[model samples]
Target: MTIRESKRLWMACGVGLLWFLLLLWPMLGIKPDGLEFATTFKVFGYVAVAAVFIMFFYQVKEAGYLDSVGKPVKGAAGALAAAYEKAPTWLLLGIVMAGAIVYPLVTERYAHDVAISVLIYVCLGLGLNVVVGLAGLLDLGYIAFYGVGAYTYAILSINYGLSFWLCLPIAAFIAAIAGCIIGYPTLRMRGDYLAIVTLGFGEIVRLVLNNWMSLTNGPNGILSIPRPELFGYEFRSLSSMYYVILGLAVVTILAVYRLNYSRVGRAWEAIREDETAAELMGVNTFLLKLLAYAMGATFAGFAGAFFAARMKFVGPESFTFLESAMVLAMVILGGMGSIPGVILGVLALVALPEVFREFELYRMLVFGGAMTLMMLIRPAGIWPAKRVGRRSEEAE
Candidate 1:
């Protein structure tokens, strides 16, 4: 059969088998969490409908109802396999986008706290992707910028009684400065040495926060960090923070996307491929690396400032090495250098704990096991850059 005809049948089988896969989740004598069921069902229902619609579109298109004047090689099976490999990841994206939108509409619809936390991480992941994934800089001290932003906002808002709105830019600027400070000395290192230095930098920042009682109030942290008030219509409702965070997340994604495609992005890619070669090509490798570090930290700082303002409390414990490593892990686990991949990694890492609460005690163990399996199964990443092309008989 021709490649086109082969794919038509392959997709058909995939759709047909989806139902059976759902059944594998187990329905026999299943116990439900009655209260959360409605919310859960709403989430699943929207996802299911989206999946059906997509499949319907694909079905109609394949039947020649939709004209495709174009189309790949490796015979029927190899090309079919390549197509199938990509389908699941894209399908999962549609489901995730749908869930993120309708999630707030579920009962108890305004889980602002949960929503804000998620967005903060989203911002964090995007930022880290630049450093670890794009620039090939392994940063384990990201939380330093976070702490700086938090304290910058905290001190300014409390002592000077400055508005959170006004403090936002200042917080970001200070975080950028902190990023430069950390990046300067560490520019000469790479790999594990870089990781260790960054890790130490993070500890130093936290210790300063913990012992600088004269300035930070030490362990007590700051309290009642002001929340964003829009047009004097302050957010008394939970959804307000949700919308604010959503707005920030949208901005973060956009900025990161632009950076990913810009001239600077090309420089980072060159550096990632080979630092020495990139520098030799007049890329200003050292400066670019520092820029990545600063820019990445600035993103975290923005999120941290917002986090402090939203939560109304902050402390050293919250911004630690573990948090830094976790964010890096998300970026790495999600295909490094892939924006969407980093996002997926964050969602899975963050959500799995909530989804499988029954296995709470073994969460870390399960997490390690899953990572090990992922390494074995998809060594490149959950979403690698592209399929490496191979020679064909026709080309030969």
Candidate 2:
């Protein structure tokens, strides 16, 4: 509110605008014919105006100018939170389940497809949450397990004429084995080194799938993977497939929720908070770490099998590092270690792209900007997990 602070704020904003313009010009203004400034300047002008407006609003709010307007809104939010806290757990779950059950019936085919994708990511996100969120392990190659499950189901269904239901567990088991293989050597590593090793393992899986023609068909991908069946009925319709994935997601949710409060979950948390201390407490860090990876990969394997069934195809391209990163982002964005947070994250990231599909070229630009803004504003996540115990830093 002071003149000096106002000047500093404006100066920072101006510098940021100029830097943004510099970056935007190269991307939007450059052409084979010649450099152009009109389009770039137009976009820059809109952004600058929005930025200025936001900055001014922030200053006004900070100066308490908006207190009158904000009070009622804040009070309403507080009341809502209080009511939510008082609500029964089963009632809340029933509402959510009802909505999910009705989603496919109300939406069109495209929406069904998107919903299916969202559910798939939900499973993937929760699985990753076990390792990265609960166990405090960084896994950049998580999609490799996804690929393993998909290809496992794909090959089994195609080669031996196995049923989708039968191959699901087989795929999950194989993915678990793969997880243990990846987790073993990295037991001693931590932080960035562990991240690098996991990244390598993910790429190694992709490369094997890409080059191993005899097994994976070398990028041609396995095709005609049968849809899941119950009795003699096949899930040939999108709506039916949606239900199938919904079931898997529900199962994943239950399994993860149980694990989160289990003794194993507590041990993983202990290991995450301090591995050395956990070992001193006789926590068997080695086997538990392997179990974390196995459990995480098992869910991903289920998802992969479902994915293969849904798409009727499996390819190396689908299991790329970028996919892994996006799933990880979903976990971080929603709130690490929180089941609901992971689901919300999956919905946001998956739905936003489709929602912005009309924007065509600038969709990613907008998406990236939104993500950056979110990280800056809510770095802890949209819905961070609640910790059971206070940390040293929080002690007063």
Candidate 3:
């Protein structure tokens, strides 16, 4: 073998061995309460086998054997893409809408619940997409806006006796105001500095919610938040709530999709590509950035209100840096600036974990590994935005 191949083989072996040794503690050494290992060596054996497979795969990859095997897979993917591109837009939309509408009726309760979770993230993802994807603004505290919406609904419902529908707009407007407040101060910043400022803002929001006992009830959280009512009928059942959220998600998707193609969206895209250039071309950079932040916050606020009503509770714990990270991950994984890609990301990141609940503890491991692999293999994302002629404008 060549020196390069030899080095790659050694690297692969080292990585596989390192992975197995590092995971040994959590996988085998520490057992959860009331859990049985059944066989002392079962987990270890699996890890060992997995390590061997990884080493073998790496060796094959280094030797360039995977190129031959992957040709068919690539060909199939190309064929699927071509077919999808050739299909009529209305047909695809109809198929998707029909499936979504009938999903709750056909699926089991657990699946429906998971679907609701996916939809919530979809809404959040689309909202963030406007700022991060379109405007090139990094927001690490997007969840703070979400929290704002939930708290708005909770405070209004309990104190003022406002209905869910009435509180929805209020929550959105309040969250937008919060977004503008954050944006106004930080619009001059970019990249890492912007991220740090947003992160601090998110922490500040959470701290206020946690410490303000008179308003948020501190860590105990506000309970018994009322469910949404439709035409005087309270949506108490899981199925009923699922439908309500489905309708909301649909509206959100439509609104975002429309906005993505509007004049505002073009301006946002221009700013994302080059703020200086966009500003030179007569674009109001400051105002558009604030508008982007507010618009994204608006959808997140909508989702937050739905989340509060659905759970019948609002807690400071629910809005955190980790939650913000997950939403950002969804936007990145799916493909920034791509609406359908964001939805796909939400489904995978949200539903896959619930599907594999038995291995819940290893979720972070999987997510980290998946993200690493994605960055290395497909940095542009699963369904990256393409700049094709007039067709691109129409398709998007």
Candidate 4:
């Protein structure tokens, strides 16, 4: 057989072997009914999935022909005009519809936890991208706004009798306000100093939540947060929440894309490329910086609100620095400036782990190692920013 066929056959066999081993876990010396057994099986599953992903990554890297894209992408567009020209909206619409229909089937029968988490992360990552990726702002405590959103919805709706739908806008508004508070002082700060400030800011929020018993109920957090419903039906199942999250994610993606190509987006880009030059050219750099921060925070808030509504839980611990790091990693690791790349990065890093179920701890370690290695190899990310095609090529 040819090498390609041989590879496929080997992969198929490997998968079969994995399933056999998964089934045999209980039959081994481990006790089936004990907590230890469950934990051990979970770890086994994680190691298996991690091994598979690493193997896949290595195989693809060795191939060296295809770029390490987060996911499939349309051809590169050099400018806003190019993106508009190449996008072909109708086809994109068709694909979105197909996805919406498929999302329910996949999440309901197969699994829901990981997919939901990824969808939430997708929204959060896209939100953070506005600041970190497009606007060149470092927001280490982006999760603070997420907490704000979640707590806003949870507190208002649960305590004072508000609706989940009403809380969405309110949560966003609160997050925007918080963003302005952070952005005003830090506009002049950039790079390491700014990074440290944001990190500190995130910690401050978490501490406040822990200490401010009246404001955040200390460690208890807001529980029994109401879920969104369509018409008379509450989003009772995980599948129900999946659709809601998916809709929000789509909206977030579209909004980010629009901003990326709009006048403000250009202004942000100008600032990112050279802050002094942008100011020299009358970009209103300060206001734009604040706007970027507010908008980015607002989106995170929306995601956090949705998360609160679905899970019916909101705790300070939920919006920790590690969460911030993971979200930032998703944005940077995905490809800072590329939407498709970001999506792919989220899927691989966020979605894959939830589905696999076997390798949570070790998988994280492996991914951390892989990311460090990737920084050395391709710092721009898996899908590097594409330069404009030469006009000389048109003559040919």
Question: Residue 312 error for model 4, in Å?
Answer: 0.6
Q: Which residue segments of model 2 deviate by more than 4 Å?
A: none
lDDT of 1 by residue, 1-396 (tens): 357876786677567446534542343223474323443454446546766787677667666665543232236667888887778866976786677667666736435455667788889999988898889998898978888988999989888988877888888889999989989999889889998999999899999999999999899998977777767877655676776777778788889989988999878988887999888889998899999998898888888888888778889999988899889888878888888788788877886676687856547756886898698888767876542244486468
TM-score of predicted structure 3: 0.89
* Candidate 2 lDDT tens digits, 346-366: 988998789878767777777
- Candidate ranking under lDDT, highest first, comes to 2, 3, 4, 1
lDDT of 2 at 175: 97
Q: Residue 254: error of model 2 in Å? A: 0.9
Q: Report, for all candidates in order, the number of backbone clashes.
A: 0, 0, 0, 4
Report the C-alpha lDDT of model 4 over 1-396, residue by residue, as the tens digit: 357964995688588557746654654436645524665566567667876776667666566645545223323334555876689888878887797658778655446767788889888888888998888988898888888888888889888988778788899999999999988898789889998998898899889888889978899897787789667799888887888888888888889989988999889888887899999999999999999999998888889889998888888889899999998998888888677767877987877666656855456655765788788898888775453344466667
**Candidate 4 similarity to native, TM-score:** 0.76
Cα lDDT, all candidates: 0.79, 0.94, 0.88, 0.81
Q: Which has the better lDDT: candidate 1, or candidate 3?
A: 3
Q: lDDT winner among the candidates?
A: 2
Greater TM-score among 2 and 4 belongs to 2
TM for every model, in the order presented, reads 0.73, 0.97, 0.89, 0.76
List clashing residue pairs in candidate 4: 45-358, 46-358, 46-359, 70-344
